[model samples]
Target: MSLELRSVNYPRRISLMRNNKSRLSGFTLWEVLVVLFLMGVLLTSFTPYYGSASKHVRLQMNRANIQRIEGAAQLYKIDVGTYPHSVTDLVYSQKGMSDWQGPYLNEIPSNPFNSEQSYQLDSSGRVNNSSAN
Candidate 1:
C-alpha cells in the first residue's frame, strides 16, 4: 500500500478567500446610488408641501398679530376717546392727547407678510396688511 501527500496551492486559496470577502463586505456602487436617488425623490416630493405649510403658519401668525393690534386699539380708544392715529401711537404718547394712558403695546409688531413694512391702520380704525392688497 502506498500513501500519497499532495501540496496545497496557497496563492490560489488566498485569492479565492479574498474574492469571497470582497463580495460579502459592503454595498456596491449601484446600490448606494439607488439609495441616494430614492432619498432625493422623497425630499423633492415633500418640498412644496413644506413651503405651503410654512406660508400657512405665517398667515395664521399675521391674523393673530392683527387681532392683538385691534384689541390694543380698542383699549386705546376707551382711554383716549378715539382710535390711535398710527400704530406708533399705541406704544408712545401723543402730543395734545391729555387722556392718553398708553404705551398699550410694548412695541409695534412688524407685518408678517412684509418685514420691511409695519401694519396699516385703516381709516375705519381697523388694522390691515398693506402688502396684502
Candidate 2:
C-alpha cells in the first residue's frame, strides 16, 4: 500500500510540473509585441496632456510669485510710510514698518518666462510698484 502511494505521488508531482511549464510558455510573440505596442501608443498619447499640466503649474507659480512680491512691498510701504527705495531695499532695509513682520519672501521673485525679468521695483524715486517692466 505504501509503495503504491509513493508511485502515485511521484507521477502527480511530475504532471503538476509539466502543467506549470506549459502555462509558462504563455503568450505568443505576436501577443507580446501587440501589448508592448499598445503601451507605447498609450504613453505617446499621454505626453501632451502631461506637458500641458506642467505648463499650467509653472504659470500658476509665476502668478503666486507676483502676489508674494506685491504683498511684501505693500507691507514695506505701510511700515516706512513709503515704499522701499528699491527692491533691494526690501532685502537690506532694517528700518521697515513698525508692525513690519517679515523676511516677507524667501527669495526675490523671478519672471518664469525671462529669468532676466525678475520682479522689479519702479524706482521713479517714489512709491515702488513691483510689476514695473
Candidate 3:
C-alpha cells in the first residue's frame, strides 16, 4: 500500500507541473509596447490644456505680487507723508526722516511675464508691471 501511494504522488506532481507550464503567461512584449504607446498618446493629447493652466497660474501670481507691492507703497506714503519716488524706497531705509520707519518690504520682486521688466511706481505711488519710462 505504501509503494502504491508513492507511485501515485509522483505521477500527480509531474502532471501538475505540466499543467502550470501550459497555462497562459503574463502580457507579451508586444502588449507591453502597445500600452506604453497608448499612454504617450494620452499625455500628448493633454499637453495644450496643461500649458494653458500653467499660464493662468503665472498670470495670477504676477497680479498678486503687483497688489502687494502697491499696498507696501501706500503704507510708506501714510507713514512718511509723501509718495515714494521709486519702489526701492519701500524696501530701503531713506536718509533723514525719522517717520520713514521702513524696510516696508524685505525684497523687491521682478516681473513674471518678462524678467527684464521690473515693477515700477507711478507718480501716485501705484505699482506698474512694466519697464520704467
Candidate 4:
C-alpha cells in the first residue's frame, strides 16, 4: 500500500501577516499633522532672536564705519595741519589745501541702520551718526 502526506492550511497566519503589513506601511494623518505643528512652533520661537541679531549686526557695522571715518580724518589733519572742514574733504581735494594727500576713503559709507542718512563730522574732529541716539 502507498501513502501521501497532506498540505497544512495556514489561512489565519497569512491574513494576520497581511493586516500587520498594511498597518505599518505609513504614518497616519494625525501623526503627520503633529510633526508639522511641532516644527512650526520651533520656528516661531527662533524668529525674534534672529530679528534682533540682525539689528545688532547692523549697529556694529555702523560703529565700525564711524571709526574708519575718524581715523581717516586724523590722517588728513596730520597732512594738512587742520581737521577736515567737512566729510567731503576726506574724499576730494579742497581748494588751496596743497598738503592734502587723499582720497582718504574711496567712498563714504551710509548708515547701516538708515540708508537715507550719512555719517557726520563734529567740530571736535569726531565722527558720529546724527540719527543714532
List the candidates' TM-scores in order.
Answer: 0.76, 0.63, 0.76, 0.72
Per-residue lDDT for 17-47 in model 2, tens only?
9999998887989899999999999999999
Provide the lowest-lDDT 10-residue window in model 1: 1-10
Show where candidate 4 strays beyond 4 Å: 1-27
lDDT of 1 by residue, 81-117 (tens): 8888788989999888899988899988877777997
- Which residue pairs of candidate 3 clash? none
Q: Pick the candidate with the highest lDDT.
A: 3
Give the winner by lDDT: 2 or 3: 3
Output the worst ten-in-a-row residue range by lDDT, candidate 3. 124-133
| C-alpha local distance difference test of each model | 0.83, 0.70, 0.84, 0.83
Q: Of the candidates numbered 1 and 4, which has the greater TM-score value?
A: 1
Indicate whether candidate 3 or candidate 4 has the larger TM-score: 3
What digit string (tens of lDDT, one per residue) describes model 3 on residues 87-112? 78989977887999888888887777
> Weakest 10 consecutive residues, lDDT, candidate 4?
1-10
Q: lDDT score of model 4?
A: 0.83
Instruction: Give the per-residue lDDT of model 4 (tens digit) for 31-69.
Output: 999999999999999999999999999989987888888
